[model samples]
Target: MTVKLTNIRIITCHGEEVIEKGEVLFNEKGILDVGQRVNTDEHEIQEIDGSGLTVLPGLIDSHVHLGMDSSPDPFANMKNEGPEDIAFKAVQQGYRFLQSGITSVRNLGTRYNVDISYRNAVSVGTVVGPRVFAAGSPIVMTGGHGHVMAIEADGCDEVRKAARSQIKAGADLLKVMATGGVLTEGNDPGATQFSEEELRCICQEANKASKTTAAHTIGTDGIKNAIRAGVTTIEHAYLLDEEAVELMLKKGTFLVPTLLAPRLILDKPGAVPEYMIDKVRKIIADHKISFQLAHQAGVPIAAGTDAGTPFNTPGLLSDELALMVEYGMTNHEAIYSATLGAAKAIQKETEIGSIENGKAADLIVVSGNPLENIRCLDSLVYVFSKGAIVHHAPVNKQEKQEQIV
Candidate 1:
């Protein structure tokens, strides 16, 4: 199938310029051309009129959990469900994300290696979903944060073996619980869960398997340890200090702030426990300073909402972009973080990040300019993934009546 999109405003994220009247051409394999104009034989192509729409590369979410339920105690809920149930929920979430204009997502953690199976299903056209890069069951310490659904191991040797096991199970990436978390009861969010030696062992094992590592770190000490050990990305650096920020910049570590998690737990009081709410509030207050410091120090940042959490849905990733703007990023910068910056973190820069020639035709068209009002992303007119239209809003009744008359 060949598609010709013309007369649209395009933001390529290739440079600092926006093309007001641009054209894009795509075939069954990938994008063929993207520029100001390209002549095509009308008889052999399907034309899509984009007279007053803005087109952008499909957004990518770097941090997400597909198997999570919509309850506050999702971990407990997962424990009761079987692998088949989990797979069904994961496919549903994946389609929801696609409808929201997100063409790809990284699954940070899952139980029974369900993400790998689901990824294969999508690749073979048996399922309708986004491109998935999954991390099979995360590595955690016994009784540590995320232990409910993670593979719990202690000591350097045990951690290394666990990492190898995950790799053998077809994990695209390795996830380690480097620090405590808020959602799990009896775990202090300010404590480090893994020693430096253990972290280094996990990283080394993952490296041997030719896979990247993402550390779930929040405290300052844990953040420093993960950065020094050469992990690829840091998730939720809530208590980041000046030294940690500097080390991150020096080591060229990318940060996935997951700004929505803190805000969701704080702003919506009833979604979480009272004790959890207080902790989240305190963390949010402290996060403002560290987040601003990271921004001022030139640390690389990516937009990840940690979706599937309570009050954080898959289709609401645009809220993360708004939070970035509130934290001193321009609208274009926020959008770029969600697109090109995220692709860079996942090591997929050449494939699906931007509206460039010879790339996958994963794109979204909106009725208004998101560059001016970022909220316009919510009103998607059409969504195309891999040269196929996945979502299209129906024309209104008034317009249909006028056309009939």
Candidate 2:
């Protein structure tokens, strides 16, 4: 069956001017047409009146961990959690993402290929959630960052083998720990992890399999190493130096700034472990500066909240966007970063991320114009995934009877 939405304002997020009073027609496969009245002869069309609402492409979160439980003891949940238990929990996390208008997500790393299985389940419709591109596990050194979910390998040959293992297990991308992370017990967030040669080997293997590599680096030399080694995206690059920024610009590497991750931890002292509070507070100020510098340097910025962490719950992309604007980006630039910029970061620009004909009908409807005030996104009235109305609320009784099909 075909679906038609009429009387809606469209923000393509493609650098195109907004289209007021537009129409959108789509099928189960993809969007058939957008803008003006969709000319269709199909009699079994589901027409929805979208008056007083603004529609745009669904959001994309470029960096996320689907299996981690958002709690004070995040790592504890991973200790004894089996595959089935983690997968079931991930299903819930995914629905929360969709309800918040996030239609596509990238799972950066998870234990035991759980992220890969979760992504497949979403793809086959066995689970109801966003379209997921998953990186099965992180390639780390022995006792390295994210050791729990990491494929620990010390040599370049071992790193290449690790990358290939993830590819064979159906990973859409490869995640490497280029630097130590805050969450890992006793790891210095300012220290580099793998050697440059090892990073290059991993990147080379992932590129051969046509998979993008996201390097988790929070230190200066580590960030530079990832960029020089041809990593596709950098995550948590708060310690970015002049050399790293120049290298990122030269290589055209994108940044998935998980800015709100540490802020969430630092804000609620009791919700996180004591060590985290100290660690996050130390670099929170510099984190803001790094993002500002990246924005000023014209680096491609993708908004990715490291959800499933303590205090950084799912469905907080709005917070991330607001923070982006606060840091330096305009409302339009912030929205674009989450939409098309995120799509390109994951190398899926041709399929989704905009209101275009022949693309996936992943979209959200809000009560007010998000262009003028992005806070309007907090008022989502309707959400569509692949032309199916996955979430909806009727305004009144009489209209509800007519509008809800």
Candidate 3:
């Protein structure tokens, strides 16, 4: 069905511009037109009067683990569930994200290749969810961080083979555990897990197949090594220093600063293992400072909540954006980081990042202007995914009549 949304404020992230009192025309295929006035007859198309609403491109999350439940101790919770149960939960999480206005996401790591399966299911109409860019499994060193859910490869040759294996499994991108992590027991978040040579090999293999590489880098040295190895994006650079920030700017590498992950871990103390809590306490202050440094230095920062990590639920991108604003970014910059910035991180900029003609109609309508109050994103009125009204808020008869002109 063709739909025309008129008299609304548009946060078209094509540039630093907003179209006030404009109309957007779209159908099942894609966006047909968007400007001050749509060039089509209003009689045949369904018209919606959005007088007090603001429309913007749907939010994108660049880092997530869909297969894991977002409990306080997801690792312990995973042991009780079987593979089928985990897969079912993953699907439910995807829908929850969509309902919360996230139109696209990148699953950086998951067990049993469930992320890839979920992405395929969505493509074939077997399920309805956000656009998923899946990484089948991360490549990690033996006994490295996330080795249980990842493919353990020690040497450079093994890393190359591991990269190819993920590609064979229909991975949209390749992720490498370049440094230790907080979740894994006895792992040092400040220590490097993968050497420069192994990381370079993975990057080379991914480059051959035209796939992007994301590095789970936290330590300063590991972050620099990933940058030098030509990784596309770095995740969770919690200990970024001046040199690391400079290297990122020089390499034009994007940073998926999943700020919500560590904060949540700290907030829900005693909910997780003591090791996890200690690790977060040690790095929480530095993490915020690193993010501020990256933002002020103009490093490309994408908003990702690291959903499925402890209390970091699937629908917290708004909170993540609000945190970014609290750190150093303006409201518009925070929104851009979640939209166009995230699309660029996953190499999907041409399709679903912004509200433009011929792009996918993945958009959300909120009650107030997000640019004025970023928290308004939490109040979504409608969600249009690929030109379909996937979610619509309930309203009274009189309110509905006034909205659906």
lDDT (0 to 1) per candidate: 0.85, 0.86, 0.89
Models 1 onward score TM values of 0.95, 0.96, 0.96
On a 0 to 100 scale, what is the lDDT of residue 286 in model 2? 83
Steric collisions counted per model: 0, 0, 0
Judging by lDDT against the true structure, name the best candidate. 3
lDDT of 1 by residue, 1-405 (tens): 799989989999887768888899987688888889977675678887776678899999989888887566677788887889889999999999999999999889887889889999999999999999999789999998888679999999899889989988899999999999888887888899988888999999988887889999988899898999889899988989989989988988888888887787777777677767766866787776777788889888877888867667777779888888888888898899888888888889899788888999999888767788788787787889898999998545464333323
How well does model 3 score by local distance difference test? 0.89
- Candidate 1 Cα lDDT to native: 0.85
Question: CA lDDT of 252 in candidate 2?
Answer: 92
Q: Compare candidates 1 and 2 on lDDT and give the better one.
A: 2
Give the Cα error of residue 121 in candidate 1, in Å: 0.8
Highest-scoring model, TM-score: 3
| Candidate 3 lowest-lDDT run of ten | 396-405
**Which regions of candidate 2 are displaced past 4 Å?**
396-405
lDDT-sorted candidate list, best first:
3, 2, 1
